[model samples]
Target: MRTSACVLALSLAAAGPAIAQDHVHAQGAHGGLGTVVFPNSGKTAAQADFIRGVAHLHSFGYRDAAIAFRAAEKADPGFALAYWMEALTHRHPLWGQEDLPAARLALSPLGASSQARVARAKTPRERAWGGAIEALFAEGKEVDRARAFADSMRRIADSDPADLEASAFAALGLLGLGAQVGKGITADDAIRYAENVFAKNPKHPGAAHYLIHAFDNPVRAEQGLPFAREYAKIAPDAEHALHMPSHIFLQIGAWEDVVASNERAWAASRAWAKQNNLDNAVLDYHSLTWLQYAYLQQGRFRDARALIDTARTLMASGPANARYSLWDFWFQYASASGDWKSVSVADPLSVDEAPDAGAAFPLPDMVQAGVAAVSRGDSARAARILSLLKARRATAVPGSYSNNGYEMGVALIAGGIARLRGDQLGAIAFYSAGADIEAKGSPAGPPIIPPVLLPYGNLLIANRMHSEAVRAFERELLLRKNHSASLLGLARAHRAQGNPAAAMQAYRQLLENWKRADADYPPLREVKAGASSSPGIILN
Candidate 1:
């Protein structure tokens, strides 16, 4: 039994001077895979560069990986793996995104079939690699192709245990499978594969990076924190690497860490864009979105508002799709801060404002609009928003990505509308429906925009359903511990129900949690006031 570590060392030793020369030239930009040799890549400087590209690909640096692969092709036009890797770069396995046109163009120079591509390979291992990629691009449903591709990679890895790249790619395929099935087993497989690679090489970019994606939700988020903390250090230059840790941080509610990670990532993306002469650096948008969310969570309202304005300015000149994320950030910030006034600003847009407005507007925005309307005593506006949501829901495809949380959104909005109409029973019914849909949606993670449970619990408290409100707030806390809004609600519900002990406990917890929060943040001020008024809640 050849251990992965032994094989890795032997593989690096086999590459000899070419690997060192490639490392010296590439200067560790290939994500720390300078030593791992692809034996079939012809032991040349060009092949070494191709392996560097593979390392970048494993770390999710698709743009940089494509550039490196292209450079390899320029150095050696006959390198079949270079072309194959370039095509792979176009497919984001976890994001359900594929640039098929670009992939087809990349593969055009090579023959059509796997057998044809294999015939051009200079080594048996290279033939196997080409065949596996061909299986991924085979004609079928996207999920089916992904499953077939994962199977091929697993077989290849099993046959050649030294092929850490094959194992890493297989882990990515497992993530795709996990995403398709919406189950944890495939994600678990991905974690196991990544851990195996880590056991051999701790600094392996794919091992650390894929581990973050594998456990990005609430239940498993802490499991990835060790990797998350190390990933930025492992590949500091890769924008995705710097931004990836924030996924875990967000899941864990580490607002400060989230802010720091995205700040660095945003700056790096801007620098890279300037150096490369790319005007519209759309890549920075992702980090900016995360950064704004973090700033809002920290009660840095002024900072968050400034970031939103900056995002708006960027979108004016950026890609059209940038509007979707920028709008999401804006909506999330306003909702989190209880800024209902902002929500009322867009109540009059017709459904036909854009061809894809239905998908773009979705349930969360409608729910927020409806909530704002009801809060302002504008029942007519709330009703209008509800009607639009119902119409959108009626036309939505059941299992499509666009409609993943559609039912939950409808239920929450309908619930809010019922509460406004003084129908407590109807409100609870709809709110319960929303909670059920959310629970069934999959592994519980950070609260979605306009959090279903927080508002649902608030409605329950308003209706004097104290016990039910306590349960609702407790449920939200399980997903997001120490959440200020939920904690305040929990404290009030307990107080209303005459449980001073529990109320005091919750009030004390909220004060401690928000002590470092902005002094002027309404929630922090409210918590401080509550602590002062409560008999047994002493502020330390």
Candidate 2:
């Protein structure tokens, strides 16, 4: 990521030349010299200079930036951007240690001014930036502050008429709200906003990332896969970006594309890590985990195992916190592999471990609920409890932990169980409702486990919409190509379509990908047997 200063400098540099063309004007301190420029032209030179100072800090000149920021603010006390810049420049340790208190104080005026601006600004960008500033403040592990920020952002977004930045900011705000609600936002809404961003500006910086989130739409895999491919092409160096949409491809049953995306993510992460000395075990884990999954999809157990070992070693030596994330990767790996014992072996949590289990917060009871549900075949009970847990999330307020995705996943599971019990309509309704909410933009967006597409694909399959199911599976593959469950869903869809050849191929692919399952593969011996036996196409 570019430093704040660098981004600011770039933005200002682009505008600076334009400013020079305007009639030069000077003002002493405050209105003592009176307003020197047209009110329609926006702030004067001194006010903008303060904002530039904030951006300068990103270039690693904090002291200089701070001095300039102070001088500019002193000259133009009512300037909102100046306060915003002051807040951003001082918020983090650009050069050394951070001064959070001072940062907050500096930005406080910006927040106030942003509110004022939002109330009166005629331009959408001005209003949107107000919301963006508030949304930025909504971060942290809690929900209250996050929700407030989200609400503010939403207000700004709703007020704007097709503003691209508003779309982005709204997505971010909604994501935060979704987290507070314990499901984040509806995946549909998130995608809509993301798409709005792309529609508004194809060259937008984070458009692909937001678009990747939209694949949660059960019917968007076909379109999403192509989008993900294009996104990867545009941002070849963004490892996380490359990996995110690949999972969707997996859901849509695009095995080849899934493998390609995983490879891209892995390659990007590896190269970036080597070049930047970034000890990002999380990024590496995501990359390698997907690779292992791809291999398993190909039924190459040995290769999957090799990748797992390497991932484990890399994570173990990377960082202490990284060790904990490894647990999730390994857990997913084991589950896919059908090795229940490995779950225990790879368990990073101990009695001595922190209460949050490395997430630095309280562990969500849903974790236990999910474990019990998955462990016991009481999917109904699991689903029910999960729904309750989600519904019970804290309200959107400052400093609360809502995590909408967490709730959505539970609801999705409930819907999945309902579908498995032959209630197709009920399942669709549940999944669809959660999907709608998850679609909104939240700070954290959706939960990784039991992703929306997981139940979505299953529901499509139960309805006997094999082609749609295939598309869903492919979409999931786009987000996580190595997701065994998605691969299995694709295989099932192929079988249901009566493509015996395709079914066999998908099943074999599932078997290969099963190797990447650190041990989570549910050990269903009859999966392939049933898949192979029904050479009959059962498309609805």
Candidate 3:
């Protein structure tokens, strides 16, 4: 969103005057917020608050950072950098969102105009920093603002090689540019910039955190492990830093690590909210969903189901994403466990509790009723669902991660329809298209559920294309390591292809992966039976 000159002027004029007041906000040690060296000329209280805000900013704890920055403003009204950092918090380019009006308002109190704000800076470096952020909120399209900010930040970082904070901001601006203009620039370029900072300070929270985002893919997941291992430790008090390690853990197939990471994140978020006298509705949902998926992967069906109740309880009053996250968990559980019989039967929530269709988040697929209709071979309903999926995908920005995600959804629905009509060849073609799409944007977006490869492999095996099925399942493993559903399909494909040894190996791996699973989980029992029957198979 662009705030035009006229709009910005009116906003500034309305802001009228700058008044500094003392308040008791942003207090607390907030210890372990990683390391940063941002020297400023504010008074002692202002300096402490500004440094704390920088720490929160590095960890992507924007709200907390804003509070800290506001506290600094209270401590020292003339601290130009505090409003600058507060303005920065209002713009989240990585999340593809920014409150342009709120951002302009944040700056309005700093000065009557951009040039005035820069003039308020006590140092040339601070002036440069202020100019870069002002360009970010400049009058133009979002991409133009990002490009301008990236150019300005690049200059700032170049001007002072010793400025670690400048280098970090430069890297972040580039990342924002990537997210704003999809498929043009990417996180890869930003990763190189962040790598330089990381080399100098391994404990820098932003450097470590950005590296994890850049390396969130099967090919580079191991590379992210170093940063992921240290980020939470660097900022153990921040909810986002604690949760971020799971991104690498999920990509690398570290089930236990994913579980542990999200568990701590969810708990910390709740603890912070309660301590601050906030409602539970402010708790983070991203980690909650990841935690639920980790439980399903470990075959903890009861635990996964419990989250469904939690999701439903919050859908009525929690954040807008409550419905979307609830449905994501629902679809993931049903598909992963292959327990469709208990899907609607055991679910405590009614259609109203978690509606299949809503204005909530605009998820393109995973309409519970639509998937059910496909399963029941209701051709008319399936076609309607497919049309809706295509329409949703069309609305997504081209070459964007969401575009690819919705495209995959459209392909899956088409494939499901083909399978329902008994066109095995047609079904395989659609699933293959989905697999191709999945491979395109895995590194950039929020996780895509029910990986396209799972159904593609199952269809290949159904067609007696055993070797092709093996390749498909192998690809699935690369995308999501130790996926039990894919593992089962891989074992079956191997057995069908007369590779008894390979089949036995896959089964043993499945058994081990499911060691924490409930004994009553049917898939675990089946894998155990197969392992027991195969004498040459190694099982511990």
Candidate 4:
């Protein structure tokens, strides 16, 4: 899948503004794709420089590319390709910040004659600039215009199946348009028809990645699992295959399987990175980061620690650039370990501005109002507002619609606030609503955001459903590894079921791990405070 906008924005934001003195800057100054300066290539050093900047963009090098492209445009006023490349650079996942507007701005300057000339071009190189512009419309959710562009690209690619570059670029545009409109099946059909182009030429740029995403849907994902595995076998060194397997394991809550798949990917990819000295710092950080979670899941605190130590070492060697998303992972791991200090330092919610769409329901204020109303023992008003929030979650955009985890988390927060307000039944009602969402698969099952499970499991334990609570905690622990609250929940459930030894064991482990870990856990600060010193059990 194309990197999500959120990932792009977050990565860029974390990386901060570009640093000027890096040795790496010069390497990216020259385009990786080597230029073809034909006679009348209209090619100046400025155009070549701009195209080099465009090449850097393929690997999330937006910050530096922006500088080069802008300078190139300044050098040559009538350079349409500069403008075109500038526009394409923003289509990078990082461009999500201001993509729709940037796309419109890029396409605005092309004269009618220029577009017409592009449309009539006999060769794919002549048309690459124009086709890419149309793909931007598709990115912005403009369906009709996107479809026209896809049709044009398709015709050009079909005309010369032997021209692999044109075929690959055209395939990419079609796949992108398909994804935007949720008609990815059209992309699947088109790819199957053009499979010969790739069969004859395996190393075509973008072809392999585009085919993997566009054709690997629900039905085909399962049917093509064999081929995916085959791809792994054939390209034994490929990191792309690793992402799919790990993600699939995650989706099914196969935590151990996820660990194994990620390990293989880490082994294969990291070996390549270290050997080539190719951005090993950032990639190694993430690899070990995943390993940390995997270790934590299996109750291997020592192993988890080693992995985290490795990540920190690699990150320290880098330019200290990046949003340090690795910090979020640390927070999550620490939270599971019951380290409130970690939570305080990292402040998980520090970056969590309530999503803009939440304005439609006024969630922060509404949650606050509802909490306040319940504090005054006004269950009716609290219920009304929460119900409104729930409805909005149900009806939002499909892609934007968060899973039950967010709802579950919200419900838990609301319920806790209500309980503090001295309205136990009101709290129970909210918990029950969240539970219903979880059971109904609205929040979804398996591969869910792990933190969301804590409150739901705690609510189950509070309500005296010992087995259900244990299962909930177990399911969550499967994903999280060392979740402190889950361990606490398991302890409580065991205690409730007359398993004193198990309960004591779980509680001791939680306390000991939290004490030993760095204390940056982001999720369970509240729950840990509530249950930390309490010995036996609190079913209420």
Candidates 1 and 3, the one with greater lDDT? 3
lDDT of 3 by residue, 288-388 (tens): 88888888778888998888788767665645552255566666667666656565532212233222343233543444445655665676776766666
lDDT, candidate 4, 1-540, per-residue tens: 221111111111223431121111123423232221111122344654564454344223454456666676677554455565566655543111336667556545544444653554323344554565555554434556556656666665565454444455566556555645544446665575336444754432234444555444333433333333333333333454454444333333345655676788678666656755667443634444555665565455556655655566666666653434445455445544544242222222211234344445333344444433443456665555556556556755544225354475457557866776767668667776765555443211122133445665776677787787777777666554444557767877877877766666776666554543434544224234434555533443
lDDT of 4 at 531: 41
The order of the candidates by TM-score, greatest first, is 3, 1, 2, 4
**Per-candidate local distance difference test:** 0.70, 0.51, 0.74, 0.49
Instruction: Show model 3 residue runs off by greater than 4 Å.
Output: 1-27, 182-184, 314-325, 341-373, 376-378, 392-403, 443-446, 531-540
Model 1 lDDT per residue over 231-256, tens place: 88777767888888988888777777
Q: Over 4 Å off in model 1, which ranges?
A: 1-38, 322-325, 342-349, 352-404, 442-449, 529-540
Residue 205 in model 3: shift from native, Å?
1.6
lDDT of 2 by residue, 1-540 (tens): 212211211111222321121212222221011111111113443544553352233222344456667776677565555555465455332112345567667766544454654454333334445455544543454456555655655554455434344456456445445544543244566667767766755544345555655553344555676566666544443455567666566655555666677787788667756665667453455556666655655555556666656666766776654223555554455444544453333332232333233243223334434543544467755655554544444433323334554556555666757656778888777776665454442321123344566567777787788887787777665555445577678878877776667766766666654434334334334344544555443332
The C-alpha local distance difference test score for the whole of candidate 3 amounts to 0.74
Question: Which residues of candidate 4, in runs, are more than 4 Å off?
Answer: 1-89, 93-129, 135-208, 211-221, 227-245, 252-289, 303-326, 335-344, 348-409, 415-458, 466-540
Locate the minimum summed-lDDT window of 10 residues in model 1. Answer: 1-10
Estimate TM-scores for all models. 0.86, 0.52, 0.86, 0.52
